[model samples]
Target: MIDALHTHRPRIVVIGGGTGLPVILKNLKNRHVDIAAIVTVADDGGSSGILRNYINVVPPGDIRNVMVALSDLPQLELDLFQYRFKSSDQFFAGHAIGNLIIAALSEKRGGIFDAVQILSKMMKVDGHIYPAANEPLELNAEFSDGTQMSGESEITAAGKLIKRVWVETNDDSHKPEAVQQVVDAIMNADQIVLGPGSLFTSILPNLMIENVGDALKRTTADIVYICNIMTQKGETENFTEADHVRVLNQHLGMNFINTVLVNMKEVPPAYIDHKKWNEVSQPVKHDFAGLRAMGCRVISADFLELKDRGAFHNGQEVADELLNLIGRSPDEE
Candidate 1:
């Protein structure tokens, strides 16, 4: 079995958004593994949403980030891809150079996926980046109090308890190509990783796609979840570690995940304050006792670290832990 597994490196499918997914991709790029990043396309804010609305393209912010993370380019080229324009003009201000490039390509090709393919070829990205859906989708959140909110930004800003989330679309504008690619990747993958990002906005939004969720349920891959280090104020205000798993199961169905990765290292109070993070609602401490009851194995490790202005998992450490959990000999495979 080990020899057969070694015949081909494991294929990995990582689903999420924002900085979190990119960080993971950056580390995994160096490994001899096949990777596919299925990014959330529900963003309707900032430059990405602006381009999406004006040009009718999929949000490129997350896609750009993933591309940069997986790019095999020189440091200078990587920096160039990440550069943003600083202008007083509200429209162009804060727009990333990569976003603009993607927007222009979308105009040239007349489709966002086409633009992404072009950019991927140019950057020589180590993995594939795909949008969760082709249609410009509005995220709808139904609160426990019977309140409905539209837009990911508004839902996160509402500070209300979300009972459930669904994509708002009249026609079946889902991208069949992206869906088929994800299904094929999942069917052949050895493992699938689901986020350490915002539960509602970044992670769950991708899984809410009907076909995406269906593929996940049918895939033979072992699913693993990386729990977030800190909770978002309006999103998961007082959620616990177990709460994350429970919520994920609610959408993807029960027994969907096989392993849960949690940060076991103690975070320094100084680092926490420097990052302006309020641990008032600290990470759901890995509910080892409770997780065992749910038939999920809990993998504890010191994967947590402080980076930029927030708490993050040390990419190297995270990769090492995950590789170990999957029984891959880091030195050999």
Candidate 2:
């Protein structure tokens, strides 16, 4: 809402976390779109997990990446911010400078939301970066075997078929809440994007928030889901395009998505280096008929980009398609 000059441009709210969210945001930052990112805070892994444990702050890894993606800072400054301490530094090993800064800012500002907003200004971010909820969230999941697990890392490590996922705070009495800005962004957006990340851990954790889910359900914007290029081992091992959509609808208790961006380019058999891509199992299967049956307007293209023997969404191509979709509103049609 602070971005007054771009008021005339299409407003987009991109929601999710992990490496994928940043890729999409980087692609969209230069475009003439008004962008706001709602990132997940359920992470309990890596440098973020360490800092969160020690400082009692919301996980900063996803938020840091998202901020960098939208930032207009010079390459060297950004690199310095992203720099991690060496393994030899026992006290600060593996912590990104940006994560530490965010942790300190969170303490100073009294919460993660304001810390990010202030940093957005400091970093000259081209878009708004809002944590999905103000507080740190714990992701809990129920697997098909009728077993339950807590923590994002543990759930993925279990490698069990997930039945459902939800979020809560460590303090049982205090429920996590989305800030007013996040709700307003979703409600007023011209286009809303979900995923290209882990369906359960990265994306669903945000939507499971009550206010966020309500905003998604009531928003007038055309909701679009960017399905992942590959199946995540513990998340969606054999998921088809429709299966991805089905999980979203199931979680939200509504068929809210209007369109699905699917990758049409096939991955050559034995092409992906599994050792390099530890989390990926295989290319996501296509189910055009299934997607149509669920009332989705499917947009299939060669949205794939293979690099270092790994599959990913071509960010520029995906961003262009999103712009084209948002441009032709129902009223215009």
Runs of candidate 2 with Cα error greater than 4 angstroms are: 1-7, 328-333
Candidate 1 stretches greater than 4 Å from native? 89-91, 170-178, 274-281
lDDT of 2 by residue, 160-207 (tens): 999999999978687778999999999999889997899999999999
lDDT of 1 by residue, 1-333 (tens): 556667787788899997789888888887888888888888888889888778777788999999999998898998988898787766678889899998788778876766777789899998888777655667889998999988888887787898888775524465333457666777778889998688888888888887888888888788888888777777787776788888888887766878888888876655555335542255555567767676778888888887655678887787777777667765654
Query: Which residue pairs in candidate 2 collide?
Result: none
Give the distance in Å from residue 258's predicted Cα in candidate 2 to where it truly belongs: 0.7
In TM-score terms, candidate 2 sits at 0.96
Highest-scoring model, lDDT: 2
Model 1 residue 238 lDDT score: 74
